[model samples]
Target chain A: MNIVIIDYGAGNTKSVQFACHRLGFSPVLSNDKDVIRLADKVIFPGVGQASNAMQMLKKSGLDSVIPTLTQPVLGICLGMQLLCNTTEEGHTQGLGVFDVAVKRFSNTLKVPQMGWNTIFSLESNLFLGLKNDAYMYLVHSYYAEICEHTISQTNYGLNYSSALKRDNFYGVQFHPEKSSTEGAQILNNFLTL
Target chain B: MLTKRIIPCLDIKDGRTVKGVNFINLIDAGDPVVLAKEYAEKGADELVFLDISATLEGRKTTLEMVLKVAEQVNIPFTVGGGISSIKDVDSLLKSGADKVSINSSAIKRPELINELSAKFGSQCVVVAIDAKQIDGQWMVHLAGGSIPTELNLFNWAKEVEMRGAGEILFTSMDHDGTKDGFANEALSRLSTELHIPIIASGGAGTIQHFVDTFQIGKSDAALAASVFHFGEIKIHELKENLRKNNINVRL
Candidate 1:
């Protein structure tokens, strides 16, 4: 399978590539539009500020090519946030693939919400074999609001969409690459689909 | 609620784990890759690798170990012991380390914390503070807890947070390796004084110690070495005990 990891020049794509290789797929990391388009599956994974990531994505033209991906595409962390309509982080605009808006986690709770937390209300194929209330690793200060596309939800002082799906495009607020066992299973499920 | 993390730390020397464990099921006591995979499978929330080797060759081995562990274990892990610069942090991160912990080097150059945090974001920087009670004051120690610094423990913790450190791994020199328990008093003080998450390291012998660190110390995570390495305390069982104590843990 041709698995291409989008390199938007922000987050570390090494771990994501390593995760895929562990799953028995030889994944390629690239920013080339042709490489991304011709791939069987694409992974949009990133870290750092949303504005900077969006800027990098636009500069490379992956910003436009990403939303147009017809094959299965998974967006993780910053990549997932970029799929939303807009984000309060740096007041950046997103790809608008999903109709949700990203907002900073309320100060009533911790900002980053780092560490392991459970995800429930699973409805996507990405969670095919996973049980309800499965724990996943999360590390971010901003979260995508619960919307029609939300396939999974998590509670962290407030309920938010932990995972979202709109057609072939899938997004997760948490870092499945960093999450142990269950996280690998999620990636496996995504690859199978 | 975010659950308190139970981390198993491995002391490495020349890419091999320094602690010789005799767990019957373990593949090899000194192989870091084998031990790290075992810890991850056993439900450890995270893993830490402390490279005790001070040689140039040993640093390269630590990087190789980081690559091996990051590829095999699908969990967040931090690397520490010899990291001193942004280049070191960059190399380790590029090798797949989720975070980099700075100890003596951070003490020598306090601004190293700021530079690393600014460049890589605070979440990627973990400042490890080794402190001991000297003359009734908790004074920071350096050079693997042999030399003393003028920085007070509490004040240093606040500075670590202010300087953009994502977390503080506080290891009490007095309690470290003693196996009595974690220095809950110091840990509690650090937690209260600092807003960022505090990982209580140093002394952890039993499951109760983990519970005390979480409940009493208010630590966001508990890190242990000998206890976990020797199989003296099983992480799954310890987590079960914590769960029974009404403490949230990933089971």
Candidate 2:
């Protein structure tokens, strides 16, 4: 099965691609809609503000094709925010893959948590092999709040949704591509699905 | 809760790492790739590579070295030295560098901080400030400690932070390679003043120095050299010591 990583002029695309290459899954890196549509699993990764990211995605016509994907689609970092109904980073609409809305974190804690942090899996399947409190890499200021689809949660300043699953669509605020062994295992689980 | 970090810095000149006692008698440590891979595998939270000899050559070769080290390590890495523009950062990030550190360029044109942050986000740009305590007042130094900028450390650091620097890598030129300890006074002031994470560099001589720096400096991360290069202390062992000191760190 071809695993396609959608590049919307975001960050850490090559590392994600390289990690997939090491996992025996040579992912196809492209912004082309046709290539993404043909893949068995699609991994959308972005590491920038939601508003400007949506602008770039719309310019590339990804905003139209993203919600229509029938395969198991995963979003990482800002990719997860773009999958939400709305984001506070910019004045733009998301693909509405999930019912939640993304908002900026409170000024209490640091804006961007840049190291490894623990995430407790709230649901099954997506975190089958993963431990209950495995640490993963995170680097973001905006978070997706819990809705009807939150499958995982992590507390920072207060409790916030770290992982969400709705139908075949999944979203994670952490970077599985940059996280250590636990992150690789998460990617492996995403692959078997 | 987010755990603080400990980083080991490797100063490379002409594609080889060098060790100095009082910033002299530079000895060939080892291959950059080999050492970087060792540090990452040994549980180093992050790594910083400074091209110490940027004046001798251009940036093409240094970025090539960055690509080589990045291919072998899976951790976050920051590259600095002679990076003058946005295209330079793009090339390094394209080569898999997680962060692009700027020193002389940031001092030359403060707008570079805004430009890079606006384009790639502040989290990707690290402003490295090398300051020397002169007449009891910390003064900022530029051009790899070769020249002094008239800007004061406190004012300059706050200005850079306001301009959208994701993090600040502050080095005390007076303490660098001295192995006495960190500039606690400067670090404390910066830590309490800015909301962004600060990585303390220089004067890391012993394992307790790291613990003291973290506990007293109140920095989010502490970066060291010499000790790690001469095998004075292993990265994991230092982290264990930091943990024993009641500091919140990833073990």
The C-alpha TM-scores of every prediction are 0.97, 0.94
Give the range of the ten consecutive residues with the poorest summed lDDT in model 1 chain A.
A105-114
Best candidate according to TM-score: 1
RMSD of each: 1.5, 3.0
For all candidates in order, the CA lDDT equals: 0.89, 0.83
- lDDT string for model 1 (A1-193, tens) is 8999998778879999999889898899999999999999999998877888888999998888999999999999989999999999889999999998999877666456779999999998899889999999988888888899999999988899999999999999888887887898999999889
**Local distance difference test, candidate 1:** 0.89
Clashes of each: 0, 0
How would you encode candidate 1's per-residue C-alpha lDDT over B49-160 as one tens digit per residue?
A: 9889979998998899899988898889999988899999999999999998999998888899999977777788899999999999999999989999999999988988
Candidate 2, residue B86: Cα displacement in angstroms equals 0.9
TM-score of chain B of each: 0.98, 0.92
Tell me what fraction of the real C-alpha contacts between chains A and B each candidate also makes: 0.55, 0.36
Error of 1 at A48 (Å): 2.1
TM-score (C-alpha) between model 1 and the true structure: 0.97
DockQ of 1: 0.66
Candidate 1 colliding pairs, count:
0
